[model samples]
Target: MKLDFDGIRLQAPFYDETHREWRDSVVRPFIDKEIVPHIEKWEKDGDIPLEVYQRAGEVGLFQTGYSEAYGGVTDGVDIFHALITGEELARPGAGGVAAALTVHSIALPPVINFGSEEMKKKVAPGVIKGTHHISLAITEPSGGSDVGNLKTTAKKDGDHFIINGSKTFITGGLKANWFTTAIRTGGEGIGGISLILIPADAKGVSRSSVGPKQGWICSDTATIYFENVRVPADQIIGKENEGFKIIVNNFNNERIGMAAGAVAYSRVCFEEAASWAKVRKTFGQPLSKHQVIRHKFAEMLRKINSTQAYMDICGWHIKNGTPNAADIAMLKVQATKTMEFCAREAMQIMGGISYVRECKTERIYREVRVMAIGGGSEEIMRDLACRQMEL
Candidate 1:
């Protein structure tokens, strides 16, 4: 009778008992108290309030993958903890909230990886405390999945670098207190790119709200523009020309998180459809009475189950720091497909209610497009997987 995913093979060799307790004590309670009640309001409002993150921080939800010295409970890429967070996050019915709250996961990693001790002392602790919002900006106006083609340029003079150009489809952009922005410092292609931390309050920095959007309204998507904004040279993350590798690595983890969220989202859709099939009747019987409907539900379950297994495998590899790029890339493709498939079938089972805002399925259906598009597109994921495998 329990609806939660008991069969989920989390592929966690890394998650010890402490992480499991963290999931039950911190993650699940936050979902029940804060997210579930207000998610529909957030969807209608087109953005989650900043207070949500503060609350997440208050409860220690925002501190994972951060260090003990900076008010963070965990350090390094604690993949299992992140996965648990993503799984619980799936219950919110809005991927936007999940993405928006967790933007720091991508945004701060480069800084933590490459910044000075003073910078880390100043930034990471404040951000971990939920008083700050950070965005990872790599996608330029001209480039979506292609990070190397980004045209936004950062030119250095004196002790400062002047940043120019724009970025679009930026999750949490409208609300970010600071940005780990990708900019061109050299000539064309990958070697030319560098990342600089751009404070939102900086001069020449501007943002505009984007989207009445397909989904993720709970996230404040925006387009940001920089017209020769001056930043201190120390704001640069790592060496100027070394950013391409950082961006690529950042993307792989982001994609893995997306894959995890997608798997959880698919499970939600399947659970909803399964429940509906037993209650909603046609021809004087429940929808499950029909063999065709049963088959469809079975297929949906199969996809969710299959992708979860594969994602678990990838997660195990990542936890131990032996990531196989092809495996993770394929997980991205398969997981997104599962989300899309389950969303479609859940709608079919629920009928008219599913089409309306009354049911969570409509929101999820709109969101499935983004899972396929963001963190790298499905097409890009396939090519990368194939290239890595030499297939």
Candidate 2:
């Protein structure tokens, strides 16, 4: 029983030949050649080079689920293609690699969906081509999940808006060419917020690194500051005070991608543990021969399979234009919890060997907390789900 990477994936009817060709020909080869080989060095250096993004762009990795007018491949693409791309990216077990390369996934959608035609034309092509980078700046130093209370402000001043305040824990912040930011434009709460695109080179816009983090090491995290930054009023992503709806919509898609990645990471943990259990001797024989160790594998598989099914159902809802935020939120919680459990059990099975760097399980073990907290914390997700349930 030799379990390879693809062998661990649970087969589902949702995927077709397009998804398989994407996995087998495009993403898997790219990960093996580009990401898997250099992940250790990139993780150690705390950054992935921009060239990798350029290459990813060249191969249409960033084109999925996007409009063809903006260099995206949306003719036959759906949510499943995006999910497959995300899952294969996680196969290397370095979440940061996926995080850094795909930061635009969260940043660009608002611009595409609601921005002016000129704004979309200006921003989308370069980013999709991987020649430019963008970051979503919503989480502030004062708050994380509480977007309604964000303190960042952009005051109207003639033809331009004067922006102030700061954002923290922003993925891809350090290298971003533009920030799709949330600012208070009205009064208070969700109604006050609006999304704007701020050029990183704009005067009064500055950033500093927020490392060394516990995990996602290869992805550069940052605290970005805006001191009386000025931008054209037209830079706003949507109508003033209506950005909350855009943000919520973005969150649903982001959570779906995160859920897919989390489940894939869990599978990676299971694979590493199973491989180790077969070879590493204990007592009088291999660890897999022991009942206790065998049970661990069974438990990991049970969780992984269940989470994969939940993710697929959520993806289907999204594809059919009937996404339930509550289910997506719960699915994210389910996937991250599964990743957490699998990483722990894999560590226990591998013993001290799992504690060292360069080991996928060890790296994933460090990343569990971020996965649980980043998209929306487990606490917040549960609360959101319950609110949607009206219970």
Task: For each candidate in the order shown, give its overall lDDT on alpha carbons.
Answer: 0.84, 0.93
State the displacement of the C-alpha of residue 383, model 2, in Å, after optimal TM-score superposition. 0.3
Per residue, candidate 1 scores C-alpha lDDT tens digits across 181-222 of 998899999999888899999999999987688788778888
After superposing candidate 1 on the true structure, give the runs of residues whose Cα lies further than 4 Å from its correct spot.
Answer: 1-16, 75-77
- What TM-score would every model get versus the actual structure? 0.95, 0.99
Q: RMSDs, each prediction?
A: 1.9, 0.9
Model 1 global lDDT (CA atoms, 0 to 1): 0.84
Query: Which stretches in model 2 have alpha-carbon errors above 4 Å?
Result: none
Candidate 2 structure lDDT: 0.93
